[model samples]
Target: MSQTPPSCPASVEDVFACVEEHTRPLSVEAVSLESALGRVLRERVIADEDQPRFDVAAMDGYAVRADEEAEWLEVVGMLRAGDWQPQQLEAGQAMQVATGAALPCAGLRVVPKEETERTGNQVRILRRPADTCIRLRGQNFRAGDQLMAAGVRLNAGHLALLASVGWVRPVVTRQPRILHLVTGNELVPPGQAPGPGQIRDTNTTLVAAFLSEWGLPVQSFRVGEDEAEARTFLAPHLTGNQPPDLLLISGGASVGEHDFTRSLLEYYGFRLLIHRTAARPGRPLIFAVRNGTVAFGLPGNPLAHYVCLNLYVRAALQRILGVEGGLAFAEGFLTEAWNPGRSPWETLCPAVWKLESGKAQITLLSWQNSGDLTPLRHANAVARLPGGEQPLSAGSKVVFLPTHPL
Candidate 1:
């Protein structure tokens, strides 16, 4: 391991730009209609047939041919929804039609049942019906109409439209296969009592949850503190027949003696893109790529892990999948004053915010340090505080990134 100190940390924007420039969108795959929700569409979905497919009744009424002064008409037939057979409507004749039923005769106007009196196949018109109630063929959409454009993230409504257009499966961008390696002999699995100088392995859970939220598959493994053991455990995964598209290493990314993640990745021919970022809570974040697979060495601290995953990991995934990614920021006023620390790095402080009378009111959570995760339980957002020693007062406008939408 040739270890001069790692390269100087880069700005957050520069890191994002570098990752975006290096990562290419994954190829396409065919997924079942039911499984396509939340996946990015790779192909434009065009209508296979016109919506409605035929002229149909839009209301429950009587289908009749308009005449100059026809006050009474003979009831010839009845049509309900899904009835497609054609029925003729002669002069002075009408047919009972239900909503969504195909019109029995061409050029016939439907008079709502409430506008006419009906008794024993005989009907009396009470009012003149305006325009026809028949929904024309292709009224909603034509056969060649584009229903959904490429690169759109499929949602419930989009799936409904696809089903309506007879798409049982959709072409979507293939989601990356992610494998996580959480290291540290001092970390014990959750549900087990931690020994002295030990803590629960929360980073794995955090990384897994974030990956699931981003619509990626999660496969994880636990490794011990030995550098040789860690290297041996990860070597097969790096050069397998079906290696993961992305590798996430949690806990061993910093400059400590046990922080061999970067060195191991370098040994495997992975080129480091950015070894560190000028951001608080996650300055040791490392990004590298090799053989078309990207690896992110996230910090071990739980709070730092959360921030780096949200900021950098999420951005890399979005670029790889060709989907809209990055933190969505909203302008809001701080409910209390905040004094930025003396560190030169930009700080991301946890906050809880809500809309009050259409205005965003934000309150900074009581944060002890980046190692503390308790404050995040009540925080839905993080306020980006500048590096200078200025104290931002209450009611000051600040931009915040929501962990979940407000």
Candidate 2:
């Protein structure tokens, strides 16, 4: 709280620093791996025992002494996978083993059954394997080995790895309670037909969909610009023992007469840290904190909401989960020419970044204004363009932030 500048408008980097300073990792909890998807891990996943603990056959073949020089050998026994009776194989003896069957003894080579002609219990060797064809013990991993480190976001593959080690439950960061309220009397439900001087509400749907990607649950509502109406919706979450960890207020972040986001935050014991930012589409950004709860006043524009959610708000979520990197920026080259108008602040141009010919390529989208929602459906990234009247040509190197999964 004290580290944040109260009056001055902050740059993107300055705001990032302030958020990092104020944010803290949330508490940890143990949950089954089945329910751990999309949750950040808080503990290391260690191997309980050696992988491939026993030497087993990698193919279906005859287990014979590697040094055997005889043209034919006696098939003493047949061993399939899960049958672990081991017997020493003499120079003239062979044991038929299925794939994944343990080797009868050391110094044994597996000759694939396809290379041998078998008649009842007797078999004739048509060819010999060049190698042992055996998977050695502890080949994959050993006991006590660190398979996965902390701060990892769990996915299907991670869960599978945990299951391989018999670790059914993993410790991960608890999901934070998020509350979002979109203010503006001019906003109407997307389902309802709008009257004159009003538009359908898209912020609610956008915010809900954005948060759903992380598997986080959020309670969102469209409240009137009046403080009393907003407080009534906030009463249930505020009066209870468990209050929202993060609160987002969309629209009214500016300095208009109805712009009461600042006043609303102050009235709720939240100390304003940032009033605005030096970034396009998100200049009227507001940030505040009270106790351990964090709040944001997001610009009502559809594109601005998209930018702030994926950029700044995502950084706060990462900090709360102890993620290693705060905000990850990827490098790409422009696939098409871009004529961006000049602006004093950096512009986060909606773009589509995809792999083409093994190269990261970005194509900036066209939007009439900041409130335009046309480009969002096609944008998978946000190109960070430096402020100027610079025209970006095709194949120009640019740095971008991925909005979708890499």
Candidate 3:
């Protein structure tokens, strides 16, 4: 009989530290600016040229020499958007200029379209002393200035900025290639009828969706049956040329006779950093590394596996891809009292926040069960309360990780 591994402190920080110490940045990739969103920056992106590259009009108006009084003159030329050449504006002369058009000349003022009377080749100044609405070159940014620093996850705004800065293709941190293996003898895919003593494999689907949401890439995902079948299926992947940066195993982490993930790791010479943690729902978590890939063994419970991944694995994967804190964390007020039970690891539960008459109040979700996923549907923040803290009271302040706005 195999002896069960000892349980250890389930501090989220300790788990993260272990992950950080073992993982390294993945390779870099050059993708088109249009598709760079959510990927980490492999290198600092400097401004290629000043935004607006030249003095440009900010509105449709008459381009005139601010130093001269122009009552009327021939509109010798028309400047529209994308017109790069600067036109000479002589004294007593005005040119028809459109928004985003290059300034007719330096020291020129603009008479807004609403403030001017326009005829063929001539414009009457309806207002005076209005300086040219010229956007100066490099006003937004200068060449060689850092536009986006390395290790930042790109967003839609970043993509627009990159395109505006004239980068067709930019270097970004390569996607983290991962292999997911789900093991169980009594599990079937969703939508399939389960036989006696069998259930649907919800963990597999949830894990896939979670990884996709994290912006990481998956190379392969296979379902493993018994020990022999699992070992055989994983053999080729372990020795393949393109080995995954991380190997995540779902289920089969317990000491059941059918569970083979732990034994398989030992057979392949992996050093397991953590075999268990004193936490609810996901106590049988395991982490290991072999050769260079980080291997993980998550509990079979769907909710528990997702919680562990969110609290630890996701952050670690981001760090491995050279990303900073995976997401943002904010502070909120506890609306009602909270009572934390004894556990080595802190529990992160959903909390809803609203204005109570005048003050802000945060309350736990309706379903707080470890096996329930309904609570997440209404959860806006993951409240972090100390494991051994005294019973929390209303109006107490707590730090929480906010959910990304939809």
RMSD for each of the candidates: 2.9, 2.0, 3.3
Error of 1 at 133 (Å): 4.5
| lDDT of candidates 1 onward, in order | 0.82, 0.86, 0.74
Candidate 3 stretches greater than 4 Å from native: 1-7, 70-74, 129-131, 219-225, 256-258, 325-327, 342-345, 352-362, 366-369, 403-406
Query: Across residues 1-406, which tens digit of lDDT does each residue of candidate 2 receive?
Result: 2333366668888889989998899998999977999998899888989988888999998988879888789999999999988799887899999999988788888889899999888788899867778898899999989999998888899999998888888999999999999999899999899999899999889888888887888988888889888877777776688988899999999999889888777777787889899888898999888887889899999899999988889888888876777678989999888766767678888999999888899999888888999999899898888767888789889988898531
lDDT of 3 by residue, 1-406 (tens): 2234346544566677778877788788899976787788888889877876887888888777878665766677788997766667777888778998888578777778888887877778777754557787788998888988888778888888888877778788777678888877778879899999988887777777777776666754556566777777888888888777888898878777777788888877787777776555566788888767888888887767766776667766777778755445566788788887655456666677666676546787655556677776676566777767577888888876654411
Using Cα atoms with residue i matched to residue i, what is each candidate's TM-score against the true structure?
0.90, 0.94, 0.89
Q: What does candidate 1's lDDT look like per residue over 1-406, in tens digits?
A: 2234346787878778878877878889999988997898878888878887888888888888855358888988888897876977788888899999999767778888889998899899898667777798899999888988776778889999898887878998887888999899899999899999999999888888777775677898998877888789877887788777888998788889879988888888888887788888888888888878988898889898878776677777777776755546789999999888577888877889999999999998876777898987887777777777888899999987877411
1 or 3, which is superior by TM-score? 1
Which ten residues in a row are the worst by lDDT in model 3? 1-10
Better of 1 and 2 by lDDT: 2
Number of clashing residue pairs, candidate 2: 0
Using alpha carbons, what is the TM-score of model 2? 0.94
